[model samples]
Each structure stands twice: as C-alpha cells, then as structure tokens.
Target: MPHGDPPVLGLVAGQGQFPALVAAGAKAQGWGVAAVGFAENTTSGLAAETDWFQWLKLGQLGKLVAFFRTHGVRQVVFAGAINKPRALDIRPDFRAARLLWNLRSKSDNTLLTAVAGELRREGMEVVSALRFVPELQTPAGQLTKRGLSRREQQDLEYGWPIAKAIGRMDIGQCVVVREQMVVAVEGLEGTNAMLKRAGDLGGRGGMAIKIFKPGQEEAIDQPSVGLSTVETMLEAGLTSLVVEAHTSLFFDRDASVALANRHGLCLYGRSDGQDGGD
Candidate 1:
C-alpha cells in the first residue's frame, strides 16, 4: 500500500461500464487489479482491464475468494450494480449455499453485509470503490444548463426528506415527485423503472429526487446516477434531477450533464435539507 506499490485490489464486477471505470481509477493510482466477473451478468470487456481475470457463475463465492487469495488480493471493491432479478438464477456453490442459508433477509444490504463479514473472516478487507476515485462524487450546486425554478425547488424540498426516509428503510434511493405528491418510489426494480412509472402516473415531467439515508454507510450503496439516469429521465419526460451532493456518484459526469442539457433537464446537487439557489 505504498505510493508506488499499490495494494492488489480485487474487483467483483457485474454489468455496465462501472467496472471499467474502477479498473481505470485503480491503474491510475498504481494498483494491481484482479477481477472476477459473473458469467451471465458481467461484461467480458472488464477482463481486459485487469491484471488477472476469472469468470465465475453467480454464487460461486468460494471460487471468487480463492481467486483473490491466489492473486494476493488484500482489498476487494464491488463495482457495478447487479441485476437483482437475474441473481435468482445464480447457482450457489457449497460455500455460497451455506452463506445464503445464514441470511436473515435476502435483501441486497443483508446479503452484501454477510459477504463482507465472510470476506473479513477470510482475512480480506472490503474497500469502497471511491477510495481511489473521489472525483466521481457529485459536487453541491446546480450541475446542468437550467437551474431549478421556484416550483421545482419546492418540489425538491417536499421530496428530499421522503427520498432519504425511503433510503433509510432500504427501499431505494430515488423517488419521483411533483406538486408535493410522490409520483413513484424506487424499489427492487431500480431508477429507470421508477422513472417510467412516475411518467406514467404524473402524465408529463416529474421531479426526480435521490438522497442517502440519514446514517447510510458510504462504503457501500452510495447513491448513484449516470447517463443512463439522464436517458431514463428524458424518456420519462422528467424535468429535473436533485440528488444529495457530496454523497452521490454522478457517473460519466460530463456526458451525463451534456445529455441533461440536450434534453432541457435541470440537474441540481444539494444537501438533503437545502434548496438550490435560483
């Protein structure tokens, strides 16, 4: 873990370009990267970014740990979101079967926490993906071409607390609101699904508000929005996106913002209780 000799980091990747970004960030910081990609869910291109790569079926926890140990990986980071519904198709190995049986609840947080505990028991540390890439965190302020109007600011004020409360309950991080009414709340289906639902319910542009739970752990499950989120908004006919600043990761920031601008979307980064200045 020295300046020049970075720790060997293990990446557990699923779908999307997130894994590649993490690999790029780790390389920039001089870390040797080893990755385990899910057979059906992960992008194969991730193997190219890593020093060593292994493919595993979902629930092959033992194999994943063994691969990391063999490669001298001391720290592991999870990048990319797993498709929860598809995870049902996972074929658990003996170790994974035991781990799954031990879970009190099958929610993502419970499963991940249990896995982290298992990793620690194996003498490996689980680190945040942002450890080497803090720049991915969204800054506080208006982030797109159009600033929030008074009405939209009020909508954000009304929705922010609800979104955070939902997040605290582990329901989800994004909520769509309009005119002080909750249009849609994100659950297992994810942000894009929630956006489409809100658009259907609201009949036009809805305000999207995302926030972290009051005491949410930053190491995992930090609120994330990206170009996909912007595209979802455009398709859903949403007007604005407001997320908790400093705690949120705005993936592919420039392109995301450019897409927002092209779609005339308002993007604001603010504290849970604060309003964007006009």
Candidate 2:
C-alpha cells in the first residue's frame, strides 16, 4: 500500500439507502470506502458510491472477509439491514456455518456479535456505522407539529417498556398498543407487517413504540426509521409513533414530519430519561 493513500473503510451493506449514506459520510471524513453489498438486499445504487464494490450473496462470509482483506481494509462497519426473509434463508459457507453452529442462540445480538468477532479474529476492526454518520441518530422530543394526545401518550407509556422487553428477549423491537392492551408485537414478519396487522386487530388508532434492545450490539445494528415508517403508519392507521432517541437511526425527518402533520399523526423521539420508561 502507498504511504500517502487514504485509509480503507470496509462496509458490509444490506438493504436501503443506509449503505450509501455511510459511504458518503466516510468519504467526507477522508476514508476510502470498499463496500460489499448483499445481492439479496442492497440497493443497486450503492456500487457507484464506493471506491471498490462487490455484489455478493448473503452468508458468503469467507468471501466477504477475503474481499475486504484483499482490498486492504482494516476497519469495517455493517450498515442497513438484511430483508428478514432473505436473512432467514441464508446459505452459509463452511466458515459461516461453523460460526452459527457455535452460537447457543440465533438471537440477533448473539449472531451479529459472532460475525464481528470473526472479523476481529482476522485483524479487522468492527466499528459502528454511527461513527461516520452521527447526524443520522434520531433526536429527542416531538418531531412533528402534532404531539401525542392524552390517549396516545398513555399508549406510548404503556408500550415503550413492553417493546424493550420483547427486544431483550430477541423477540422484536416494535410493539403496537391501544387502550393499554397489546395489539401486536413484531416477529420475523417485521415492522411494516406488524403495523398493518395491528390495524386489523385494534382498529384505526394505536401507538407504536420501537426501542433499542437492552443488549443489542450498537456496532453492527440499530433500529431504522424513515419517511417509509410514517407512510406505513398512515396506511395502517396508527396515530402515534415513538422511537428510542439517540439509539435509533432516523431518516427523512422533514418529509416524515410533514406527512405525519398532514395526517394528524404524532412522531416523538424518546429515551428512558424522558419518562423513565425504557
């Protein structure tokens, strides 16, 4: 490697625009991004944003590591998320399969930690994606013109800790509640599906709360919300949304708040300190 060349930052990219955002942010910080995108999940535009890029299938762990090492990447960040279905259907190589076989639980925290451990064993540092894109961290307080109404506030209070409980169990991060009763808790079907299902069971109005898991590995994963979340809420007829602030990655705040305002929905960023309800 040339002595004057920029440091290489490897990216393990998944679905959505997050990989691109991380790449742009890393470049802005003078790091050269060598990103690998999962063909099963990442957006097509990601390749153009990277210094070196490869489209690889999910669970090709050895190939993933070899690609980064070959390109001289010493640090890596896992950005975005795999589609739940695609991730569940992964066909791991012998190396990856061994890593999985050693895990006692298939829970997210355990699995991602093992993956990061494998990278570390190969001399690559696994750093948080937030290190490059700190501005994407969701801010605390109400983000929309409409604040949570009395009923909706009660619902959030009712559901926030419950969401964390599910997350702790690696069951899910998001929960839907109405009138202090649990309407739905997200499973492998994911948030959007859970939102729609909540509407089916609870009718027009409920509060949705998504929290960071108690033991989640911040370096590799975090809850992501965006304009699409607001759109899904509008479609599902959920009236209020709250996410653990400073822990989740939020995107398109302006558009999300505008849409939420138009639909008389509430978007609030919360932390345990806000109400001691994590």
**Candidate no. 2 TM-score:** 0.95
Q: After superposition, how far is residue 169 of candidate 2 from its true place, in Å?
A: 0.6
TM-score of each: 0.92, 0.95
Q: Report the lDDT tens digits of candidate 1 across residue range 137-248.
A: 8889999889998889788878888887887677888899998899999887888898999988897768998887665556666678988899988888899999888877
Lowest summed lDDT across 10 adjacent residues in model 2 is found at 269-278
The regions of model 1 sitting more than 4 angstroms off are 1-6, 276-278
Per-residue lDDT of 185 in model 1: 95
Instruction: Tell me the tens digit of each residue's lDDT in model 2 across 1-278.
Output: 58989999999998888999999999999999999988768998899999999988877899999999988999999998878777888889989999999999877778888989999999999998889999889999888888878788778777787888899998988999999999999988888889999988888898889889888887877888899988988888899899889989898888888889988998889986476222
Question: For this target, which candidate reaches the highest lDDT against the unseen true structure?
Answer: 2
Residue 117 lDDT in model 1? 81
